[model samples]
Structure formats: structure tokens, C-alpha cells
Target: MAIKFTPIPTTTAESWRNGGTDAHGQKPERRISDGRAPCRHCLKNVPEGDAVLLGAYKPFDAAGAFTETGPIFICEKPCKRFQGGTNEVPPVIAQRDQFLIRGYSADEKIDYRTGQIAKVSDLVSQAEKIFALEDVSFIHVRSAAYSCFTTRIDRAR
Candidate 1:
């Protein structure tokens, strides 16, 4: 199956910034009322009655100095799909508040140190430096506040 990424909504971003946590612990998965749907990563509300599931995921990998993968509920429903093409990163990502874009090498080590981007246009140039790494498979765009995975870029097929 092809890899796909969905944009996180703005409202969810606000909630996470304000302070929220998954009340339920690991193992015993929890389900919330459809009316209260929220994206585990961005902490934004999923539209009323949207289907959501609580599952574990590692935003980072296991056994690393910064391995940060964890449980998150992605939209079980289709919203918008993003594929890295045309060398353009979406405006939503470029304009996000307090974001850090980092490129990882094939060994998953952070390539050029991550930097803060004030606008979306900066991503293309910033990404160019890391894109050349031989083992780089993906780029992680994340929120600095929670260090949450906002989106990932993969080789376009």
C-alpha cells in the first residue's frame, strides 16, 4: 500500500498547546464518544461523529536517544491526502505555529540539526540540505510544544 499523510486541523493544534493528555494508560485501549473525537498527535477535535480508534504508535523509533514513537489515533476516515510531489510542502505545514522540520538519515540519525521555520516557504530550502543524505527515507515535521509527529514525507512513487 502507498504511504499517505493527512493534515491536522487547527482546532486540534490549539487544544494540545493548552495542555491535554490521553487520560487512559497503555494496554487497555480507550474509546471516546464520537462527539469528542480528537487527534492524538495534534490534540485537535475530529469532526462530530467521526470514527476514531486509540492505538499505540511510535512517532520515533525504539532504542534511540530520541526514540519518541507512541500511541496515536489517526483519522479512520479520509479527509485530505498529501503526497510529497512538485517540491512543494503544503502551506498548512509551512505556516504551522512552533514547528520543527527534521530530516533523518538511513540510519535514522537526525541529519542537519533541526531549525525553526516561521513560514512554509522556508521548508523547501531547509529540506534540501537533508534530502541528499543517502539513507534518508522520510522527513518529520513536528510540533515543538509536544514534540508530536504532525506529518511525514516519503519518496513519491
Candidate 2:
């Protein structure tokens, strides 16, 4: 299976940024970057001087215990969506020493044995190894240090 790195969709991000609501359907919590969070839309760190939104987000559309709503960062203003090459590690992942990668089943439940902390440099191959399995439906890349949702990786159609 060919892998594709997917960032948060721009439309959803725009709705949240424009104050439609967060995943919780409440106004998104806004804050200034302290240098740790990255805007999932752009797949880039929210530079120290910029504004950002801190809000709960569910990576999967499925609504169950496995559907987690965790804190995620987004630009206070709109930015271009990440368009990194397929199977390539985005700058957000590549700039870090390591990040967490984990697989999920078709039902969106976590696949226990597929979770691993991957070196940024080796991320693509690591993802390929996991996707090689028939049971794996999709994978998520998260900030290893804090385990926040970064993006999803899916097999290219």
C-alpha cells in the first residue's frame, strides 16, 4: 500500500478558526504560542510570536470511546494547508527528533502492537512497515513528547 500523509482538512480548520465551534461545539480556546505547539493545518510550528487556538479535536469521525477528543493547536489566522509529497515526512515531523506513530483498525480503534516512537528521519519507512499489515486501516502521527494529534496517514487510493 502506498502511504499518504494527511493534515487536518482546511475547511474544518477554517470553521474553528472563524469561530464556528471546536470539536466540542463550543468556541475554541485561544492562546498565544509558547513555542511548543504546531498548527496542524500548515504542518508547521506556531512560531513563538503568533496566536494559536487550543481546542479539543477528534481525529476520527467515529463517535465512541476510541474516538478521542484531545487538545490540538491551530493558527489563529488561516494559512495554507500542508501539501507535502506522498510518503514524505512533513516539516512538522521532520524537524523533531522523534514522534509517535500508531495504527488504527477500520472501526477506528487503536491497534495496540502498532504503536511506536519513530525517529523523524525514519518515519516514512516505519509507516510503510505498519501499513504493510492487512489489518491496519490508517495511522496517526503525534507529537511524541506530548502525544497530541498531529495528522493521519492513509493508504493512497
Candidate 3:
């Protein structure tokens, strides 16, 4: 199955400019390094010999008063989209890490419905269950620890 990874929205730049803070007003700045950190998209730590750029990204579409976005880097080398299913949920997802997965209702509202997957391994099963719901349109996987978004998955129409 081919899954298209959505590009981080431009609004994230503003969020970054505002100090890379989330809705909770917590600021999580990138490590100040002469070098670069890993690109979350490609799951690769940036090599010290390569170049990196500071950019803002909104993992989600802007629609509310408290929407969040942040700063990230664009790798010189393009990264491939993640194609793995449950098997590739990532080890980080399951290590007692607090995360949030929101499932949208049909009306495009918050749905007041959300799932908390403590670990990465639980994400796939939780996502599968959420996707199975007829009313859910998509899901926003976020890190509750830092309130940063990991990724968004739109149900296949």
C-alpha cells in the first residue's frame, strides 16, 4: 500500500517564530548546535558534514484558536515516505511515552474524541481501531510530552 506523507504546513513557521511553542505555551527549541540534528521525517540524524536549514512546520491544518506548529529542518537529501504498517509504528511510540491521537468526526469538528497511546507499539492497534470507526476521517498523532505532532494519517477514501 502506498501512503502519501503530507508535507508540514507553512503556518509552522509562525509557530517557530513565536518560539517553537505549542498550544500550552510550552517552548521546545531546537538544540543550538553548530551542526544539525536528525530529520524526523527521514528518521535520520543529520550528519555533521552536511548542511541544514531552520524551518517552521505545522503538522496539521490551521482551523482553531489554539492550533500548534513548530520548527524543523529540511534535509539536503529528500526522505522517502514511511510505508510500514503496524510493524513500523516505531519503538519510541511504546516506551511509556505519553502521546495523543485525535480522531476527527464527520462534521470536521474536534469530535471531543481522542486516544492516548502510551507506547509506539500500541499506536497501530489504536489507529486501526480508530480507523475502523465509520465516523473518523483522519488521525493526528502527537507527542503529549512536548505537544508536538509526529504525523497525520488520512483514511483512504
Candidate 4:
């Protein structure tokens, strides 16, 4: 099966750059990259000298146990959104040592026993295995240490 890696939605990203409030409806903190920040749109590291907006992100609509705010870094300047392709891991994630991947059900609820902290080398196989499960609606990639939102994954159409 093919896989799709999705970044934060473009509109949401634009809001952050346009000086609009974040998902929490508060102005995001403007900051420079420590060079570790993964700009969701480009799915690449924002260079050390690049600008970014650090703010809270909840990757879902309905507020519930599964829905909670966490930090995410976005480009301070507008850029194209990532359109995930098959057989490729974005550089931002590929360069990392480990990541947290979790499965969600059709209703967008977390699927039990479906989360794993995977090594970068194992991400592809791990994501493939998760997608093989029929009950999993989608998957989310996050920082294993900080659990910060990174990106979303789905079966590629």
C-alpha cells in the first residue's frame, strides 16, 4: 500500500505567519530556529538563522481526551505545503533518530496498542505495518521526547 505524509494544513500555517492567533487563539511566539524545528509545510529543518513561530497545536477538531494542545514550529514566512508522496520520508523526519507514531480510528479516536517510538531507519516499515491494520483511520508522527506534533500519515490514494 502507498502512504501519504501530510504536514499541517496550509490555512493553519498561513494564519500563524499572518500574525493571526494559533489553534489556541493566541499569538504565536516569534523565534529563531535552534535548527531543530521542523517546518511542517516544507517538512524540512528551518535553518539556524531562519524565523519560525512556536505555538500550541491540536491536530484535530473535536476537543476530547485525544485532542490536546502541543507545541509545533511553523515557518515565519509563507511557503508551500507538503503533499506527501509514497516511498519517501520527509527530510525533517528522516534526519531524526526517533519519532512517535500513533494510529487513530475512523472516528479520529486513538487506537490502542498502535503507538510506537520508532527508529528513523525503521519508520517506513513501521508505518507500513500500521497501515496494514484495517481499523486504523490515520497516523500521526510526533517527537518521541517532547510529543510535539510533526505530521500526519495516511494510506495514499
Predicted structure with the largest TM-score when compared to the true one: 4
lDDT of 4 by residue, 34-149 (tens): 88889988899998988999888889878788886888888888877776568589989989999999999877898877899999898878888998889998899999998888
Cα RMSD, each candidate: 8.3, 1.4, 6.4, 1.1
Clashing pairs in 1: 12-44, 57-70, 58-69, 58-70, 59-69, 60-69, 94-120, 106-135
lDDT of 1 at 101: 70
- Per-residue alpha-carbon lDDT of candidate 2 for residues 1-157, written as tens digits (9 for 90 to 100): 4678899999889999777787888888889897767889898888897899888888897799878778888998888998776677777777789889999999998888899999888888888899888799999998888888999998877
Query: Runs in model 4 with CA error above 4 Å?
Result: none
- Predicted structure 4, TM vs. truth: 0.95
* TM-scores of all candidate predictions against the true structure: 0.54, 0.93, 0.57, 0.95
Weakest lDDT window of 10 consecutive positions for candidate 4: 79-88
Query: TM-score for model 2?
Result: 0.93
Q: Candidate 3, residues 95-138: lDDT per residue as tens digits?
A: 33457777776545454556665455566567667777778777
Error of 1 at 68 (Å): 1.3
Once fitted onto the true fold, the runs of candidate 2 whose alpha carbons sit more than 4 angstroms away are none
What's the lDDT for all of these models? 0.51, 0.86, 0.52, 0.87
Task: In angstroms, give how far residue 57 of model 1 lies from its true place.
Answer: 1.8
Per lDDT, the best of the predicted structures is 4
**Residue 33 of model 2, lDDT score:** 92
Better of 2 and 3 by TM-score: 2
